[model samples]
Target: FHAIMNLFLLPLWFLSGAMFPISGAAPVLQALVWVNPVSYAVSGLRHGLHGFAETPAVLAGPAVCLVVTGGFALLTLAVAVWQVRRPFFQT
Candidate 1:
């Protein structure tokens, strides 16, 4: 399970611009970064820490990033609550 999750999520972390900026990335990668929730979170943090003056070129500005990150958080919270409300199998 851990390995499978890593296989799925490692790319997400990599594409979140935690290691490098996405500006010079390939178009496909840039597209992926734009859609990634983690990317918005990273962008929000970057904006908070450095503002736009020193940060790399982000696809969305700080306001947009804030909205996207908050929306993503709410969405994930809703999904988690929904999942918890569903019936579960027991051994």
Candidate 2:
């Protein structure tokens, strides 16, 4: 079910306006496009193509992305290490 849901999501995302612009649609319907997770891909594509990009928390560029991603990875690693050592402390 997980894999099936993932597969369906990819195409559904495409139809939800991630593939192209959907102008003249009703306001409510357009709102759906904006809310769709896949719509982010479209926003990114549009921004990249137009040479005007705005990623979330934009004041931070590649450096920030790198730092954030690395920080999260390190946090995960630390948690994993603690879990591994937890049995030793149970006594």
TM-scores of all candidate predictions against the true structure: 0.80, 0.40
**Would you list the C-alpha lDDT of every candidate in the order shown?**
0.84, 0.56
Per-residue lDDT tens digits for candidate 2, residues 1-91, read: 7997689577657656645555655777677765554454445445455554554322224444345446655876998898788877555
Top TM-score hit: 1
**Candidate number achieving the greatest lDDT relative to the actual structure:** 1
* Model 1 spans with C-alpha error above 4 angstroms: 1-8
Query: What digit string (tens of lDDT, one per residue) describes model 1 on residues 10-77?
Result: 99889998877787789999889988998988878878888648765565789999999899889989
- lDDT at position 33, candidate 1: 91
